[model samples]
Target: MLLICHAAYARDTSSDSILAGGTLKPTDAFDMGAGHVDPLRALDPGLVYDMGARDYVVFLCSLGYTQAQIKSMLLPSPGVDTSCGGDESDLDLNYPAITVSDLSGSTTIRRTLRNVGRIKNAVYFASVRSPQGVHAVVWPRLLLFSRRKERITYYVTMIPLKRSQGRYDFGEVVWCDGHHRVRTPLIVHVNTTMDGGSSSGSLGGLQVA
Candidate 1:
């Protein structure tokens, strides 16, 4: 078993979960964010999160990296601009997973998916598993990709309900189109009683049913 490292295919699902041993430290996603890999299903992942090199520069900028330092990481492309003009928010990066710590109130998470499967004209719908003591909803419940590599943006709003503190909750948002299921886990540490930090009241999209 001492070989090269592997990556976790899915974010978090009890269907294929392995329990942790110790009694004191009950199994939690923090213990295993990336659990394991499935070779067979990796071939056709339906909707995948894709980003360009400039996105990394933007990510770094969001992380408070200086203009000079960020410029060094980029290859010597003459006409490229590395300025962080309008970032998609720190947590709004086009990642497959979403997490919210110190969540004071309702928060809206944005994610963009690129169609990578053979089916160009695929129709996918949004499905959510709300974490304990939290209300989760996704906008534009329906997604239709006309061509391969087509990218679509979706927003997920998480509202905190009355609950316990000092614990992190787990949830997920899955996009299914009959054959393929693309899941993205939503990990949250609800701090509704916290001092500051605000969330968006808008759904960011037209429909929210």
Candidate 2:
């Protein structure tokens, strides 16, 4: 049985007659759960984002972990390089979420997705539900997969649209292949007073599809 470990990969495979509370953390959860989980949908999430044990090491290095500290954590693991020589940024981690705590200007984040559907030849197009005070766009929105587990990388460019200070806003980047709509939340915490450079022009007319 195929399993998806991340909640960001969860899809809503329910009909209109059924009420399905999704996996997104809600603002008001006093009467509801944090999120809902569908076992059937988890089994067949059309696209998935994955992270390996070694990738965490790179993430640690990006977070300013020292060489000794990183090596200490990876002890007894054979054939692993302990060098913090990678130029990979923390924002470039292969996680399915896009979050920017402070937007001082236009920022572009890259995400890679693997098509894990039963249908080998699947073409997915992207669409954006941009956040209230932010503009998000994905480049090369069309993803084509000819084989299972085929990886495709896309870039998301986000800029401040309203820049409401300390506002927590939510949006979604959705990919659909007619059968499944794979979506990821675009969370942004706006800091308007931080001299965010070039908050102008929608960062090149944000468009994904």
Candidate 3:
């Protein structure tokens, strides 16, 4: 069997230099290079969130884009009109990271993970470290992967407890299975407006092999 590897680029903070104020700051773009262990560890990542071309179409649809606009963006565009019927909200996109640009009150997002580890019976447990003023809840706290590339779905709901302290709040959701840990960052942008507006966003990370 042929083995293909993908390298992960990590933010190399070691290249950061001390500023006049004695604060360390990154002075070069190359500072965000790959970490030593990122590639090796990424190869056998216990769980990975996978996405396809159609999945991206659904995501664009969730962004409230017109069918014409979407078609224009598609290469060798389809001859027939495409619709985003039955598509979930943009927040529910199957991505490693969770982002809510216009959060108000409470909102729930869904994510799916695929087991890509060597072990067929690997199990994982979910944990969260919520940011200030935001509460996170993950349904079906435990996941069971009995076969390679098996998929599982879960939900994360962010509830705002108080007024916005700043423009953004950060958190993370992690899945652990004795050895491997799959973590995804959570970013929520507080919008006090009642209209519940939306923003354009993208997902970044590795895909399952």
Candidate 2: tens digits of C-alpha lDDT, residues 1-209: 12233333322345222233474442321211212455677777888876666667778989999878988887587777666776867887777677787865677887788878798788999999888877777887899898653888888887776566666777778888998777777777777632333454332455322
Question: Which parts of model 2 have CA positions greater than 4 angstroms off?
Answer: 1-35, 193-209
Query: Model 3, which residues run further than 4 Å from truth?
Result: 1-37, 76-81, 192-209
Is 1 or 3 the stronger prediction by lDDT? 1
Pick the lDDT winner.
1
RMSD of each: 5.3, 5.3, 9.0
Report every candidate's CA lDDT. 0.71, 0.68, 0.64
lDDT digits (tens) for residues 59-123 of candidate 3 = 88888887778788888755544577865488776766787767775677888888778887988
Clashes of 1: 0
CA lDDT, candidate 1, residue 153? 88
Instruction: For model 3, state the Cα shift of residue 159 in Å.
Output: 0.4
Q: Write the per-residue lDDT of candidate 1 for residues 162-208, one digit (tens) a residue.
A: 44378889887878899887777788887664223322354655332
Q: Which parts of model 1 have CA positions greater than 4 angstroms off?
A: 1-16, 21-27, 86-88, 194-201, 204-209
lDDT at position 59, candidate 3: 80
Q: Model 2 residue 51 lDDT?
A: 65
